[model samples]
Target: MKIAYTVAPGRGDTDLLLFGLSRCLLEKDVRATGVVQINAARDDAGPCDMDVKVLPDGPVIRISQSLGREARGCRLDPTALERAVGLVETRLAASVDCLIVNKFGKHEAEGRGFRTAIAEALSADIPVLVGLNRLNAEAFHKFSGGLATELPPNIEDLACWMTSVTAAKSSTA
Candidate 1:
């Protein structure tokens, strides 16, 4: 089953949650792959964006940068984003136990970002865990056909779900 951690904006430590969960699952010998956002330091200059890192200790690649302009927004590098997604796709092709994507944000709501990678994982019958906020919850539901479970942003809950799904898969195997 596809699962998503429903986190409120700025309320939950999503990066830490994803990192910890990935580490826990890896310790269990489950082959998992995905991307997580790592925040870089911000100074008086402005807000530094985030780096997209592959799960299970892959290289960290900067994908967004604050573009100081009339309309201030982070400039996302499509090439870098695609490369990160490609890494996930490569891992999925090798048949992993689970896939954990960072978030279903603007790009995803617009049918971009890791949308394709998520679909590929689901099509491979791999359980997916993603971070989603209220703004995009509806879109996520519509995209997943209600197959995604909204999980609390807690390690215990996530670990439990992972155990259950992996166990079920193991039994069937």
Candidate 2:
């Protein structure tokens, strides 16, 4: 049950940190699977489009929809998000050493997204790494049942953690 998460202080920093960490782990030949975000800036000064790159050479999916700039509600394309989730879920059964989910967000908070995937990874004895935000902190705590460890936002520390965790998993395997 090696579950870990990080809440970066800067806006969109968590996404960036997780993306880099995931790529680093994969380059190290760690069998990692999950989704990491890639936000594209908009020319109209609107919110950046959110896209997620599935782990282990999986496809990139756009998870955000551009609602009018004034729209206050969620711009998340649930279907697209689920597509990414489905892809990640499909890869979970393979020889995965770790799972790196970019966000434990509203969907997960409502138990409609990566929550089950995270649980499945734990059940399969695979280590899990997730990015979290403050808005969902309470829900994540409740969902994790106080078992998830908080990781530092720095890439070096995160890579170090991933390296150690993957090495341990490899040894045990």
Q: Kindly list the per-residue Cα lDDT of model 2 for residues 22-54, writing each as its tens digit.
A: 878878888889999999999999999999999
Instruction: Give the TM-scores of the predictions, in the order they appear.
Output: 0.89, 0.96
RMSD of each: 2.0, 1.0
lDDT of 1 at 85: 85
Mark the regions of model 1 whose C-alpha exceeds 4 Å error after superposition: 8-12, 69-71
Lowest-sum lDDT 10-residue window in model 2: 19-28
TM-score of 2: 0.96
Tens-place lDDT per residue, model 1, 101-158, is 8888778878988898888877766788888877888888888888777787888888
Q: Global lDDT for candidate 2?
A: 0.90
